[model samples]
Target: MKLINTEEAVGHVLCHDLTQIIKDVKKVTVFKKGHIVKEEDIPVLLSIGKDHLYIWEKQEGMLHENEAAEILYGICKGKYIRPSDVREGKIELIAKEDGLLKIDVEKLHMINSLGEMMIATRHSNFPVKKGDVLAGTRIIPLVIEKKKMDEAVKLAENKALIEIMPFKKKKAGIVTTGNEVFYGRIKDAFGPVIRKKLEEYDVEILGQKILNDDPEAISQAIRNFISEGAELIICTGGMSVDPDDTTPTAIGNVGARIVSYGAPVLPGAMFLLAYCNDEIPILGLPGCVMYAKRTIFDLVLPRIMADDKITQEDLASLGHGGLCLSCNICTFPNCGFGK
Candidate 1:
């Protein structure tokens, strides 16, 4: 460590005390290019008790150690932007004297509302530094009034549907139980219908189990499937208050915590969710899920498969545009059902 003044020192150094005063210190060098940043590296940086740090010219514009750490965490878990390809499009580019870039796309598919963006080079082989201009994107246009776009350049922000991709590849577990389908009676149409819905999301079934109207056995099946490593568990059959309807009861019996019992949604009002210890999610879908064009499942499934934990507020937000009437052509991305 090189100490230039009484205030602070640079290079890697550890201190057990915090009363130390460090002033006018420009930068610290804890890491360099080619070093992968992890969440564990945060406290080490913060131990210096400094809010910001600078890197060499070659290391500029790289996500801050903490921010890069978070992005890497998501990427390692397969919950991230698809790195297979970079999708780009031309928009009207407007650069301000302050060096902020405004981007406009046909539509933004976002999990959280756009607040800010981390711009970096899309190339996997090329190196990016702290001040290096990656792709410039700002959220100001999306949140501000119409005048905002007028003052900014129109540029498309090439975005990857991180949540949708995993959903498309996810192997699912389906549990269906109902006296109507268990006995030699009406066809077991729900399974095929639900399968079709999963097809739209490109979800594949890893396993399917059928049970009588027994909550205990149905719950056990859910546990069994989860133990077998089902990322998504979908339970169908009984989602209503009918005496025989037991799917909801079964899901709760399996020691899973419910997100909501009944939604303010039509068609699929009896939707239920439970998070296992590992955060693997289980859903008790209402019968309307099997037939309705737009149900609570349609609203919640995408977010859930994206690994987003739905909250009461998130569900409440959907009430503004909860109903989805079947149409000749579904304009989903444009529709605000789950936006």
Candidate 2:
């Protein structure tokens, strides 16, 4: 950094914040750090100080903070994500539409591992709306080493470290299992619960069927829904380990590849995930989902709607934040249930 006359400061970057104060009226920053002084800005600088200004001197192997922030933004940017204007060497990535947020945790760790730069993001695989700040990036200093920024860029090459997958418009089919519901011995509560959750996304219930605890009938119903253009199939009830529970067997009978039959989550441990023909997802929800305000289904449903393939590892990792507090008000997604 070097001191120069306000007139000569033009074209140079401000090294510190310039404050303008007025008695009880206002106290505001005239020009912030990293702002490139323009000819038009010289007068403002003179009005604030009237003499010399501290400005950053361009040097080899070094970059201004604003430039470093732009580099960081470019590295992590992906489809359906927009970046905010740089301010004080920081830039925020914003969602362009309502969708599910996906973060490459390994790549994010790799980038942050390189010293002097940082990127902080919201939790991965969670729902986000338009204008929400998904992530923020900045350098640790007023100026950073060019080589360090280059190394960070290289780590993020060929793929975005963060992305938002918009929810797809889908036609969903519902299957309510259990002889009690089919035989009218008890009221069916699962269908309404599933439908209420589906309403939060871009999904429409194409049709619904009530079936007894017959695997053959359940299997045939699943196939029929797929044939009738249902993009998502949800089979509620009979997901437990009881002798009569047969949702998992029914899903397998229909030739769907079961990703997982159970998860390390309370209130929804018996949740089953299967993909029909490697395309549509068929979920077998446990009875706990009918009563619990939040469950593993709430955690994984957004990812499914976004068309994200949930792996066994992904489900396994959820155990870290899988247990719901079951708060009276139930502030899910915002709570620690699925972080």
Candidate 3:
């Protein structure tokens, strides 16, 4: 690129965007790339403190900032994501639809490790809305070495480093187990709470059953739902170690593979997770979920809807950000309840 004083730059084509920023007011591009500078434009350029300008001059084995940013965008673009037009030496990746965001962190780190380039993305394996900015890529300088960008492309290896998995609508079955609720001594509140949460994801409740504290009865109800084409099963109440609590044992008796019977999260520590036939998932929720605004269930439900299997290690990792502050105005998911 050729650098010339603004006084001598009239009639020269701009090699990059000229940005003007006003504190707390606005930031705008005064001269676009390839813009032919006119005598009248010199005052505007000088107002923005640009005494010198870079005019496009191609050099072998070097890349301009916009060119480098396009290469960076190619490395991270994947299914269900769209790239925005390059602007100000940067490109943004936006979600094409509302879905779950997934990032290959290892590859992402490798790409960022290469000097003169960067990729910043939202937390992976979380829900994202349509039009949300999932990631952004840019060249750190006005120009970069072609070799450096080539290294980033080699790390990406022509594969997508980021993707969004669309959530699938699934039929759900709920089993509410508690003697007091079954006998009508107290109203059954678990079913309604489960229904409300499921509704957020457009899940259809196939059926619900309120059973006494009988492990056999709970097990039978689970099998019945599966036979009725229920893709997801939720068993609430009776998950604790009390004498009457038998939801966990009942889930096992139904031949479901229990991924975890407990979690490290507060307000939902007694949570249980199991999969039947390695296809259908069964959750044993404790009583706390009925009252708590957010719990471990909020963390796992999205993955389940996306058909992403949750492993034992996945549940174990929740301990890091499991505790909820239970603020007076709970802003869960936005707050750090299950980050």
Candidate 4:
């Protein structure tokens, strides 16, 4: 990685991802206060102003400004973020400059959903200078006063910085394991319910399986899915504390590490998460998740589709005001439940 000055940073125009690389980007550098490090292939070391920053090495991948900010958030937690995880947020095209495009998030309504309202912004002309504030976001608590949340939203809009959303093309795999569901005593209502939930995110159903209560068999199916390149896995039924409820055990038997066996939130208290690896995520969902108006699964599915790694602390933070009342108008689009 190499560090370059303002002139070097703006020499080459950035691609659709809004980033370029410096020839010799360094790991770290210290710039004088109010220094203008032009935007180039190098990433920003410190963004002190709308136009001043320190540049670092440029990485490959298409990413929006807010998405990059989210990766930086993972870095703060000592987590690794792949370039593939970085994606475009809300944006729209206005005109073409030379070979570059002039885009604006607010004007284009480029956001994927309201949850991304916190990271949207109108990036200025292409070939932005070093330390230029291409886009900015602030991660506040999930539960804040509605009035306060409204204020923040207004603030971001006034500054032309809104939450950007990633292109959410999600493919789902379902694992149905239960003696009752497997034996067909009762119709498998869970699959349709999960499918409807997946529809909220427009996720496609990649595959589905119905298995017995045997933990070993269930585990093998999950492993098979990993081999099939399933990015998100959801196992329904058999998620209770009873001996017959072996969904959690089945997930563990497959050697996938569970992020949280139980969450602090209601309805989905028995929700289970297992990282088949950092790339493939498996979820053992409870029966409550299938029927509840807004369970923990409802709260989490969006994050997963957005390619976020749910952590223990992140789950624990949902305890306050997690339950959802079936609203008459279903104004969830304006509400801040999952944001």
Task: Say which candidate scores most in TM-score.
Answer: 3
Which sections of candidate 1 miss by over 4 Å?
Answer: 1-168
Per candidate, the number of residue pairs that clash is 11, 0, 0, 24
What is the lDDT, from 0 to 100, of the residue 269 in candidate 4? 81
Model 3 weakest 10-residue run by lDDT: 330-339
lDDT of 3 by residue, 2-50 (tens): 8899989978889899899999999998889889999999999999999
- TM-score against native, each model: 0.53, 0.89, 0.96, 0.52
TM-score of 4: 0.52
Tens digit of per-residue lDDT, candidate 1, span 1-339? 112322232433321112233578544345433333355655665676644433222223332223332332232211222222111111111111111111222222231133333233222111122233323232321113333232222222333211122233577899989886778577776788778777755566887888899999998998888878788898888888999898887888888878778777766667787787748788888877666666787667656654657776766656666666666677764455543
Regarding lDDT, does 3 or 4 come out ahead?
A: 3
Error of 4 at 247 (Å): 0.6
Which structure is stronger by lDDT: 1 or 3? 3
Q: Compared with the true structure, what per-residue lDDT tens digits does model 4 show for residues 211-329? A: 98999989888888777767788999898899988889989887788888988776678888878866678988888876667777867775676566679887886776555666666
Q: Which sequence of candidate numbers ranks them by lDDT, best first? A: 3, 2, 4, 1
lDDT at 150, model 2: 87
C-alpha local distance difference test of each model: 0.53, 0.90, 0.91, 0.56
